[model samples]
Every structure is written in structure tokens, then in C-alpha cells.
Target: MLSQPFNPLPLDELTAVFARIKDLLLTQDKVDRALEVLVQAVGDAIPGSAGAGISLFDAHGRGSSIAATALVVEQADAAQHDLGQGPCLAAWTAGTTVLIHDAATDARWPLWSEAVASLPVRSLVSTPLAAAGGPIGTLKVYASLPAAYTSATGQLLEKFAVPAATLLAHIQGPGTPRHLSGPLKGALAGRDTTNRACGMLMERDGLTAEQAFHELLRRARTSGAPLSRVCSDLVDGRA
Candidate 1:
């Protein structure tokens, strides 16, 4: 969609949209909420986008789903995890936007295309969620039909990228840790899996928390295993 001839946008209009974002951020409860707004803003900025979602990576290189407008985010996440390729992954890895106006015909990620075809999706665009250290994740947009997103839309998404990163940084700060579920709930947050694995290792081997964690990592590297798998093995007494 972005293949068309370029047309310049006026500065006043750009500043106006940014000012509105500033106002929304001020009223938001936290950085995550602000990022939701930022994702929605990307949709509003683009003409054909039906929805948007944001994901962020932790210190462990694991990316978690944050906020999403619909099931498209879930599909996108699955595609990235399963196929290990897609706009979102590329955006995060390269710290740059990856825009694909048509997924069905795209050769970049054939497995991703086949997997996502069943979903009500077509065009997709991803902008790197970056900070001082580099990319943490992606801000992804989805359209219901092919060739819907344009280069202009990609640029607009880029404009909001910094603010999205800032909000994510705030949410993932010293005070807030990423949890998959709430405290009252049995759901695990960011370090929950790691904690559980450490506990299991400790119980099985009489090691300290730090020692167990290091052991898990050491075994994972030595055995060429995934940390999550090592954790599971410890939990299930299979390691």
C-alpha cells in the first residue's frame, strides 16, 4: 500500500496529533495504559487499520502480549513464536519498522503467512518499540484485507514509537514487574516461571535460590535446552 508516490504532510497537523497524545498520557493510570492509547493512536492515524497491539520483551528475551484490540494480536504472537519470523519479530530484532501490505503473497515468512491465513487478517505493519538500550518489542497493526497499510501509515506508526517505548519503560520499572497474572490470581508474572524453576531445582538438589537458577541456566546451555523446558523438567522431575 505504501508503494504509491510520496506526499508531504504539514507540520501543524503533526504537532496537533502529538499534543493530543500528550494529553491522553497525562490522564492515563500507568505506562501500560498509555501504550494502549499509543497503539490505538496508530490505528487512528492509519486509514485501513482495523486494530493494533503491543508486545514487549523482558530481560530474558521473552516477549509477552501486552494490550490488544482483538484476536489479531494473539495470532501475530503465535506466528512469531511458531515460525520465528514476521513483521513483529523483525521490527524488534532490527529496531526498525517492518511493513507488509500483503501477508498471503509475502515470501518473507511463508509459515507465518500459512498460519495467519485462517484468521481475519491481511495486511500487517510493525514498528520497533525502542529505547536507549535498543528495541524491546513491537507495536503491530492489522488490517482485514490485503494491501491496506501504506508507507504513510508506517511512518505515522514510527512517530508514536518513542512514546510507546517510554511508557513501556515506565511500566517495566523497579516498582513494576511483568506478571502474566495478578497476585491474588494463580497467574504467573515475569519472574514467576523462573522462580518456580528455581524452587523446584532447590527442592530436588538442595541448592540455594541463586544456585538453583544458575544451575538451570548452566544445564540449559550445556544441554542446548530452552530455559522454559529446563524449568518444566525440574517441575515435572524429568531433568
Candidate 2:
């Protein structure tokens, strides 16, 4: 519910912005780095944005802030995760865009709003990162001014969502390119399996996302096996 009137970017400017993003995407070597850069791009592309962050949900729906332009953005996302509420989490879980004109006066998530009210953030917008199955994460931009985001801003962000989700899925999915070295391919597979295992643990045992990840690492060490193998075994119910 932004109070400000929507200001659409001129077609030429919007085209150039996307062109720059395409170049940035090509330069990224890793999914994590790509997501970080994408959030930075969002901050740069949109007016009135102070910072940006990516909120990723594991398969079990537990949210974690993967990247942020500033410490305040990270803190704000963390508050939402800790409280089990916030626009980012809502966007990810519900697969919809969310906007908070002013967190201090936004009554939908009172606890989350109150918690982050002390921070420098005033307005926020979160868009769902839709994957093949559904939304797997959220892309969020924070502003220090109230009513900073408008309908045009939301539309612009929606255009970026597809590419962002695709990049993440490419890294985590099983279809590694044949050009990658054997070791590198194995490393990516291991990371993806570990993430899946962590998600499974969270859902089955009601553990927090961080706790589940640590548990996987500890079990892998105790079993004297590669983390990937351990995760695979867990997924197959063999461990």
C-alpha cells in the first residue's frame, strides 16, 4: 500500500537496466555470489532503496537471509526469521508480493514491525522467487523513507524474479553442465544434497534450519564419510 504515485521508468532506461543485469549475471561464477549481486542490482535499479537482501527458504519452508547490501538489512531479515513472521517470509511461503509502506505503523506483523522499528528501515517490498515447484525464496528491498515503493517498482521487481529463481535452481539442481570438472561437479552435488538433507531434518524433527545443517555436518564427521554421501544416505533412509 504505497502512498506515493507510481512512477514508471522510461522504456530506454528500463532496457538499459536489464542489459546491465544480464552482463552481471554472466560474470557471476557461483549461485551465492549471483544472488548477492542480484540484490545489489535491485538496490541500484530502484529509486529510494537503501539496501536489499535475499531471503531463501529451504524445502521445509524455513527462511534464511542469504545476502544483504548492509548489516541493517541482514538484521531486519533476521528479526523476521526469529519471530517467524515478516514480508519476506510471507512472500516466500505464500508465493506473492508483499509491501510494507511503513514498518512502524504496519499492523499486519506487529511483533516483526516492532522489532525492526528501531532499525533505520522504514519501507520494504518483497517479491517471491518462483521456482519450478513454487516459490523457493524472496527478493527484498528496504528503504529508509516511508511509502518508497509503488506499483511500478513492484512490476519491475517481478520481471527480475524469474531470472533470479532460474539461476538459483541451476546451481542447486541435478543438471550440472558437462563442461565442469569432475571435482567441481561433485562439490556442487554435495552442496545441493546437504541443503536437501537439512530441509528434510527441519520438517521431520521440527528443528530450526541452522540446527539441522549443523546436525548434518556433525553426523558426517562422526560417520567418517563425505558430507554428500551422508546426505544421500539420509535422503534414501540408509543412514
Candidate 3:
């Protein structure tokens, strides 16, 4: 039998949680560990989220899949790469939260609609990871049921945007010489490769890093290729 779903946090408790979340984000240490902490906290903080993922876009416009729980982010990333639709892309593009309360019935992306219906992703909330200039990428959460989030919940996630953006900027900023910091320190091993791939596309196609990365994701989806493998081939001159 299916287990009963988790209960929503009461208003008082939710307020306290947001307070704590705010305090944590204000700290340099906590900001550094934002990615890891986000995934761990999202499930408990939000009533419907089964998992979450944080994607960071580097200076060269390449995306590094940093923190992820289960396959929610991974598959969502794939869907973005594949069909070029969904809340993640919207958030990244708009530099704001993209709320899809009903994926199956939404007319936003017909291709994504059919694809996500096959998965357990009935609802989604994607908040942009921004910096001083604009959006860097997205922090996305997935739920198995539609209309799982309320306006309050969406507002809560929005409250997280400023701190989250600051954290990302600190780590990947041009002013910072350091490569990794806080929670993103040991997240992925292929970051350099992804960067190299982005650089190659920039050099060869005269595309901006962001444009190149988007193109790479587009290619990966159209050809049904894994992102790392695609980057490897680009680095090795095979693709």
C-alpha cells in the first residue's frame, strides 16, 4: 500500500523555518554549502517535493549539474536538453521562479507534457540562480502530484532567491579566483571538461558561453546523448 504523504508545516513552524533559512544564508559558511543543503532541506521544507537539484552556470555559460537528489534533477535536466521545455529553462531564461502547478494539463510545452507524464513529475517549481548581472541557472524541485504547492510555498521559495544567488555569485564570480567553494566543492568531477567543452564551442562557433552551453544541451537532447559524453567528444574532437 502507498504510504500517506507528509503533512504541511504549520504557519508558525514555516515562519521559523524561513527565519532559520535566512540566518543560514547570511553566513558565508552556509552560503558556500548552499547546493548540498538545498537538496537535503527541500524535501522536508516543502510538502510535496520528493527531491531537488541545483544547476550552476559558469562564466562560459556552461551548466554544471551540482547537487541532486534521486533522479528528479537529472531527468529534468535531460528533459530540458531533450525538448527544450519545462520550468527549469523558463526560470533560467527569465531569472525568476517558474511554477508549473499542473504539468500534464499545461499547454506550455506539448512535447514536455507527454514526456513528463511518463515520469512521476506532476508538478514543479524552478527558481533561478542569479548573480549581480542576471540568471546563472536554476534550482528546481519536483513533486509526484499536481497542485502540490500553494502561493505561500511559492513565496517561501522566492524568499530564498536572493541568498541563493549571492552564494552562486561568490563561487563562480569573475572577481573570485577560487574554483570551488562551500557545498559545491566536490559535487562533480567533470566540471573542467564541461568548461572546456563550453570554451571549445565559444571558440569554434563564436558563440557566447551561455549560447554554446544551450546549443550543447540541445544537441545532447536531439541525439539522445549523455552530457558528459558529449562534452568528452567535443573536447576530443570526436563530435
Candidate 4:
């Protein structure tokens, strides 16, 4: 329905919107309730967005929490998990943004596209929810119309993802870990991953142990990402 260029909220207004989400984070006691409200606000706030969803995943990429503004969106996300391929999962695993202009006409994930063809889910943008060490999952917004989201929309969504993820990282509720779904646990896992990544850098470039570590630091600094995230990218062969 929307063919015009997408103009997202101004930076100041957008910050105010996310500030509200942050406030919700502090007021609510239940993670699920806060998540639902947050998702609904997100869907309503973004122009042309039919729905919004947030999915949290463990280190192994299994979902730990999932919330959506509408049932159709819930089903759409479930299809991604069931089919094992979709924009959100791609964003989560790759620690990058995934934007699909039209799932109906041109789908990079043909299987998932076919699965959700009957639903009002065509254009969407998903961004990895990056935290202290690495991405914890993804936050996505969906639109019913083809080409509903433009490149600018994707960029805005990425900007929105940063603070959104920050609030989510601090959410507390029943069965929710106080930090990053268990910061200590994630840190321990990150340590192992970091060690293996250091080894990979050492072997790949024939650098000394300290030199390899410095290289990892350099990558983290240049990329403006966390060291553990840099290590994860290298270990996952994405760096």
C-alpha cells in the first residue's frame, strides 16, 4: 500500500519513543508483559508496520523468549523457527540486519516465504539484539504490503535496535535471568569462544599469542563492536 519513501521518526522523537520503552522496562515486573507492550508500541509507532516481534535466543540459537503484537505475527515467527530459516533467525545468527522488501515476489528464503505466503507478511526488517558480549537474539517489524519498508526504514530500525536491546537486556521477571539471560553463563561461554577464536587467529595468520589477541582487539575497535562479538564472528567464519 505504501509506495512512497519511508521517512522514519526524527532522531529526537525516536529517542523519546525508546525512552518510553525504557520507562516501561522499569515499571513492569513481568518480562512478558513488558515485552508485549513494547512490541505493540513498536508496531504502532512505525509507519506501515502491521506488527512487531522480539525473539530471544540462547548461545545455541534456541529461543528463550518470544513475543509478538498479533497472532499472525506470532504464526509468521513460528514458521521461521519451524522451517529453520527466516529473516529474524538470519539476523540473530549472523549478528547483522536482514531486510526483505517483498517476500511474495522475491524471497531469499524461499521455503519460509512459501510458508508465510498466506499471511499478511511481505516486507520486514530484522536486527540482531546485540549485548555486552554478543547478540542475544533479534527484534523485527513486519508489514503487510510489499515494499513497505525502504532502506531508510531498515537503517532506522537498526538505530532503534540498539536501545531496545539495551532495555531488553536489563528486563527482569519470572524465570528471566537478571542480566543477558545469565551474564555469568554467557560470559563463561564467551570465554571459551574467545579462547578458540584467539587460537584460530594465531593459526590463520601465524601471529604470536599476544599479537593474535591484539588483532582481535583491533578488529573489535575498528568494527566498533565488542571483543567477544568480534571473536564470535571470527569463530563463526563471518569475520
Index of the highest-lDDT prediction: 4
Off by over 4 Å in 2: 1-28, 173-239
For candidate 2, the clash count comes to: 0
Task: Give the Å error, residue 207, model 1.
Answer: 42
lDDT of each: 0.65, 0.71, 0.65, 0.72
* C-alpha root-mean-square deviation, candidate 2: 8.0
Per-residue lDDT over 28-107 for candidate 2, one digit per residue giving the tens place of the 0 to 100 score = 44445555667777887787788988776653334677779989899999998777677887676456788888898988
lDDT tens readout by residue for model 3, 1-239: 11455455565754565456556655544543555665666656776687877776543234556667868667766766456656676666445677888888988767878876788887788787655445666777788888876566566666555566665555543333343443233223355676678788888889865567677777777888876678889999899
By summed lDDT, the worst window of 10 consecutive residues in model 4 runs over: 179-188
The runs of at least 3 residues in candidate 1 whose Cα sits more than 4 Å from the true structure, single-residue gaps closed, are 1-28, 172-177, 180-239
Question: How many clashing pairs does model 1 include?
Answer: 5
Which tens-of-lDDT digit does each residue in 1-239 have in candidate 4? 57555567788977877676666566655566666767776676678898898877554333433678887778888887676567776776556788888898764678999999999988999888787766777888999988787777778778878887777666545567454456424532564576578689778889754456557766776888877788898899898
**lDDT (Cα, tens digit) per residue for candidate 1, span 1-239:** 44444343454655565566666556643545555556666676666667888876553435667778777777777677555556686676545788887788898777788888888778888888766555667888898878877777788777767666665554533434345222202112224555567777677789865456557667877888776677777777686
Q: What is candidate 1's TM-score against the reference?
A: 0.65
Candidate 1: clashing pairs of residues:
2-151, 178-190, 179-189, 180-188, 180-189
Candidate No. with top TM-score: 4
